[model samples]
Target: MLSRDRKWFLVIGIICAMIMTSISAWQPQTANAASPSASKVDAVLVVDVSNSMNTSDPGKIGNEAMKMFIDMLSTQNDKVGIVAYTDVVQREKALLNITSEADKQELKAFIDGLNRGAYTDTSVGVKEAIRILQDGKTAGHAPMIVMLADGNNDFNKTTGRTESQSEQDMAKAVAEAKNSGVPIYTIGLNADGKLNKNKLADIAQQTSGKSFITSSADDLPNILSEIFASNLKLKVVPLQSITANGNYQDVTVTVPNDSVLEANISIMSSKPVDARLIDPSGNTKPIPSSDVLLSKSKSYSLIKLLKPVAGDWKLQVKGVRQDQIDINLVFNYDLELKLDAPPAQSYKKGDSVQIRSYLTSNNQQFQDQELYANMNAVLKVKDLDSGTTNEVSLTNAGDAFTGSYTIPDEHDYELSVRAEEKSFYRETQPITISAKAGAGSGTNTGTTQTAAPAEKSNLLPLILAGLGLLVLLIAAFFIWKAVKKANRGFVGQIVLEIRDENTGEKTYPQYKKLNTFRGKFNLHQLLQLAPEFSGTDKVVFTPANQDRIMVRSTPEITIEKSGRAVDTGSGLELKNGDRLTIPLASVDKTILLEFISVNS
Candidate 1:
C-alpha cells in the first residue's frame, strides 16, 4: 500500500514499459518483411578483342569495367561466363555455377588476361555467348548477354567474305539469341563516334534490351555497374508446339492489347520451310530475318511487334512434309503514360497551365472494361531548386485524364505522371520546365486572329483559256485511247501455262497481250489468281518493250531458268519457248511455266 501520487506514477511507468517492449518486438519483423528475395541470373560477358581495341583502350578499361560488373551482382545466387572474340571466338571462362567471392576473383583474372587480336568477329562472340548461357541456364535463372564492341564486324577479310556478308552473319546471331529468350545489352565504346551505334541499338531493341554509347573509357565502370544493378528481367510466355500434317499449316495466335509480342518457330525437320505472318489487319508481311537482326538460326524464325493490335495473328508455314514444330510466344506488357502540356520553355510566374495525360496499360488505351475502374491516376510537380513537390489527382477526360497546375515561382520545375492500381504501375518520363519569365513579361496566350478583306475582279478571258486547255486535253485522251485500242487488237500475245510437277496436270493458261504487258508486272499477283501457286512465296516478272520477260523469285525461294539455278536477287530474261521451273519439297511434280506467243 503506497500514497495516491506514487500509485499513479507506478501505473504510468508500467504502461510505458509495455509499449517499448511491443515496438522492440515488431521492428525486426517489419524489416524482414520489407526485404526482397534475391533473383537468380545467368549472365555472359562478350568482349571485343579486335586490334582497334588495343590502341583505343590501352588502359584495359573494358577489363576493369567487367570486374566491377561481376562485383555488383548479388552474392546470393548469380552465375556468369566470359567470351572473347576477334577473327575467331574463344571461351575465356566457363560458367561459374555459384557466384561466390572466389568465383569473382577467377572471372576477374580471366578478364585481365584478354588481349587484342586480329579483327572483329562480333557474330562469333555473340553466338558463343548464347551457346554458353543455353548450356548453363537452370530452371529459375534468367539468361543475359552483355556485349562490348569498339568497331563494326570487320572479320570478313580473314574469312574471305564481304563486309555486308559479315554483317548478315552478325544479324543472324542476334536473331538466334533473341529467339532463345536471351536479351543482349550492347555497349559501344566509340571514343570518336565512328562506331556503328545504330546497329548496336537495333540489336538491343529487337531483344528488349538496352544500348549505351560511351565516349570515354573512364565511364565504363559506372555504366557497367548501373546496368548490372538494374533488375531488368525478360518476361516470356510458355512454349506452344504444333505438328503439321500437310503441305502447309496455318496457326493463329491471339495478341493481347498493349504488349510487345515475339513469336519464334522451330521446325524439327531439316527441310527448308517458308514462313510469313498475317496481322490482325489481314496484311501479309515477310518475317524479319538475320539481315534485320531479328533472327539468327536457319531452322528457327523470329518476329516481333510492339503494341500489337488485339486480335488474331496468323502464322503460315510451308514445308515439304509433315513435321513437328515448336512455337514460343513471349509478351511483355508495361504501363505507358504520356503527358501533353504547352511548351515549358517560356512560362510566366503565376500562370495557370493545363496538363493532360494519356494513360495506356501495356500499350493499349483504357476502355470501359473489367480493369478500368480500378486504376488510380495522379500528377506530380516538383520544384528542382527548392525541393518542393505537389501531387494532384486527375479527373477522367474520356480518352485521357486532365489536371491543372499553376507555376509557383521563377525556378525550374520537374513534372511526372503516375498511374497505378494493384500490380499495374506506370510512370511517364520526367519533363523539365525552364526558369519562369519575369512578371508582366510577354507569355504565350495562345489567342490571336487575323482576317483579310475579299477582292473582286473579272475573269472571262482566264475562264475561256482554262476551258480551251481542258478541251484540248480531252481530245488528246480520246486520240490516245483509240491508238491503244488499235494496237491491242493487232499486237502479239504471250501465253503462260502452269503444270504440276508430279501430276502433270495443267491449269488454265494466262494470256497477256504483249503490247499491254510492256511494263513491269508482279508475277506474284498473277500467280495468286491461279490455283497452281497456292504455296508460292513471291514472284515478279517484267516484260520489256524488247521481246523478253525478266523473272525473279522472292528472297527465300530459289528459281531455275532453263535448268540453271539463278540467284534470287538477280532476274533472268526468257524469250519465247523458254521454260521456268520452281521445285517444291512437298509436291511430287515441279512447277513448270512454259511461255508461248500468239499473234492477235
Candidate 2:
C-alpha cells in the first residue's frame, strides 16, 4: 500500500524497537548476577582446661564468658564447634558440620560442664579443630579457630618430653593450620604476667587472624560481641615488588564505609621502611616504630586499625633501602600460597622433587570452577639455567594442588602456579640443585721411601733444647694462671650449649663475651647473633644481676633454670654448677646456657 522508500523505512523502525526491548529485558538480570551473596562463617572454640586455669579463672568466669559468646552466634547461618584440651584434646560438639541454631544450647551446656585437667596441650586442640573444619567445609562457609589459653603449654610434663620438644610440636601444628587456610583467633585471658601474648599474636597474624589480650575475664563477652558484630571481610591486593627510589610510593584501596580495616604491609627484606596511612580526607597517620608489632622471626610487621574511615585509603612507603623489595599489601582479605619443597632446597642429580601448592581464599580452600573445557590449570616449573619448561598437571587434592617432577639435570629452577582458569598466578623464588658427588677414584699407593739415617749422636744439643722447653712451659703456666684469675674476677663469657630437641643431640657450645657485667643486655639480641637462632622469636632472657638471671615466659613456653622452672618475677642466681635451659619455639631442643668460669 506504500511507496518503495516508505516500506523500507517502516521495516528498519520495527527492527530498532525490537533491539531496544531485548536490552531492557537483560539489564536487571545482569545486575543481579553481579551482586554477591552474604558469606557464612564457621567457627571453632578451643578452650584450655589445664589445672592452672582453675585458679586463674576463679568462679568459672571463663565458662560463663564462653556461654555468653555462644549465645551471640545467633546469626542467620552461623555454625560453631567446641573443643576442650588439657593433656589431650576432645571434641565436645560437632555442630560445625551444619548451619543450625538448634544445638546452640547444647554447646553452651557442654562448655559449662568442662573440668580442669592436669596439663595443657594447645597443639592437640588446634589440630583437632583443623581436622573438624577441613572435613566439614562447604562452599559458602568460612572456617576459623578461636583459642583461649590462660597459662603456658604444659604438654611436655604429661608426655615426659622436654619443653623444646613440645614447642616444636606446637609450631608444626600451627604451620598446619596456616597451610589449611584456617584463621586462628587467640585470646590471652588473665595473661598479665602469665600468658605469652607475643606467641599468641604471632599465630594469629600468620593466618590473617587477630589476637586479643584481656586482663579481666568480664571483658571477654564484650570483645566476643564486637568480633561477631563487625562481620570482618577481607580484600587482598597483590604487590610483588617495590623499588626503593627514595620517594613515596602510594598504594590505594577503596574501602567500604564504616568498616574496620586492618592493613598488613609485609616487607620481605632486611631493610626497614617508614610507612603511613593516608585517608581520603588527606589526613596522614604515620605508623610509629613502637606501634609496629614485629613477628617472632622479624620477618613481618602488622598494623591494625579498629574502625577505618570509608573511602580511598593510601598506604605510603618511603625510605626503602633494597633495589627491588618484595612487598605484600593485605587488606581486609587474607590469601596465601603455601609452597612445600624438600627441607634441603638443593637436591642431587636424578632426584625427583615433589612440589606442593596450596591456595586458600578467605580461610577457605579455593577450588577452580569448571567454566571452560580446556582449563589450563597447571603448575609450571622451568629450569632457569637450562631454559627448559615442565608443565605438571595439578589435580584438586582437597586442600591443595599437588604435582611432582624429576630433575633432569643439575640446574636452577623457578616455579609458577596457574589455576582458577588462569585467573591466579603465583611465581615463587628459584630453587637450585647440585650434581651428586661421584665415586672416589682408587687410592694411589706410591712407593714408600726409607728415611735417611738420623745424624750421629747430638746429645749435647738435645740436652740444651730440653732445658729451653722446660723454661718456656714454666713461664706459660704462670701467665695462664694470671689470665684465669682475671677472667674469674668478671663474668668473661657465657656458654650456650645448643641441642636438638627431637634427637637430643648437642651441637657446639656458643660463647658470648660479657665485656661488662653491670651493663644491661637483651638475651634475644644476643641469641640473634647465632645462625641457629634464625626465625626464632619469643626468647625471654632477663638478667636481674651479675650472678642472677630471670627467665620469664608466656603461655606454652617454659624456661628451666638448673632443671627447675623459673618463677615469674624471680631471678635464678648463678651458682658454680648452675645451668639455664631455654626452650626455643623454632627448634626441637632446649638451649642450655651454662655459666663456665674461664679459670675452670
Worst 10 residues of 2 by lDDT: 28-37
How well is each residue in 1-600 modelled by candidate 1, as lDDT tens digits?
Answer: 346787567555544554554445433221001112223578888888788776655555566556655654534467787888876764344466543455666577667656566767677788778867765566556788888886476654545866776678778888888898888898887755567888889888888778887755435433553454343222233344556665557777666554332222223233456677787899875566321113322334444454466778887777655565655444333435667644334566776667777655434565533344556778888998899898989876656667787877888778787765432345566676655555223343541211111111223343444455654654675577577545432223344456676677765445454455434555545455545555564666665334456677776666787578778567776654455777765555455564432210
Q: Residue 163 of model 1: what lDDT?
A: 72
Candidate 2 per-residue lDDT, tens place, 436-551, comes to: 34422112132111211222133334444555565565467557756654553244346666778788777644556555643345455557556666433444443433434444
Shift in Å, residue 59, candidate 1 = 2.1
Error of 1 at 564 (Å): 66
